[model samples]
Target: MRILLIEDDDLIVESLTKALTEQHYVVDVATDGETGWELAEAFVYNLILLDVVLPKLDGFSLCQRLRSQGNQTPILLLTAQDTSTSKVTGLDAGADDYLAKPFDMSEWLARMRALLRRGGASLPPLLEWRNLQLDPSTCEVTCNGQPLHLPPKEYELLELLG
Candidate 1:
């Protein structure tokens, strides 16, 4: 699984990267919201672990921006903002879940599993690039209306690259 972690705290980033990697998740880190936004747009992630307080852009604004642009990826907000208003704002801004700082790792992992099980957001049925079309549901690839059969390794590579 791939996860994007957008956080600025060095200690938190180091700890989470170690923990998530131990679980076999490929994690991409972005310390600021602008970089996070760019990374989110350039690649697909199974989940995004976002800190509510960030440089360049706040998590609430970033979350709202992502939702406004139709990004369906599951977002879990992590922050020190533990108030009811913060939780509500996070959810209302399109975060799938919220976790305050000082949370239990086991609980956090459970939340991650639950959100991933839900499959979060979905991409369009057909993904297009130039004349090439890929159907994720059928695992089929075509170019310029012609079938393009490829080996599984190549197919998986192309899927990831696309």
Candidate 2:
């Protein structure tokens, strides 16, 4: 899975990146909301981890903009703001989930998995185009019963095409 992490805090970014990478997730980091938005526009990610307070643009605005543009990528807002109003605003702005600061990594990972599983509402458990078969949950592809070795980008492209 690929994740776009938009956070300005270097320490948090480093820790999260390390943990996610160790779990075999491809992570891209953006220090500011503008850069994050640009990257999000240019690439297709399974999930976006956005911090509420951001430079150039706040997470709420970014989430709203992405939704306005019809970007359906699951967005998980990470913020220090832990109030009911803030959580409501984030969800109202189109965030799929929210995680407060100082959150446990396991909880974050669990939420991410849930979002990813629920994100592709129309996607089937198995995709087949001619002899090509793809099982997204396992990241396994096969052609005529033979396993196909695909790099991450290729796999993503195939999934998109499928």
C-alpha lDDT score of every prediction, in listed order: 0.87, 0.90
TM-score, one value per model: 0.75, 0.78
Against the correct fold, how does model 2 do in TM-score?
Answer: 0.78
Give candidate 1 misplaced runs (Cα > 4 Å): 120-162
Model 2: lowest-lDDT 10 consecutive positions: 116-125
Candidate 1 matches the true fold with a TM-score of: 0.75
Candidate 1 lDDT at 121 equals 49
Regions of model 2 farther than 4 Å from truth: 121-162
Question: lDDT: which candidate is best?
Answer: 2
lDDT of 2 by residue, 1-162 (tens): 678999999999999998876555679999999999999999989889999999999999999999999999999999999999999999999999999998998899899888988977733479888888998755789999999887766877787887
Please list all clashing residue pairs in model 2, or write none if there are none: none
lDDT string, candidate 1, 29-71, tens digits: 9999999999999999888999999999999999999999999
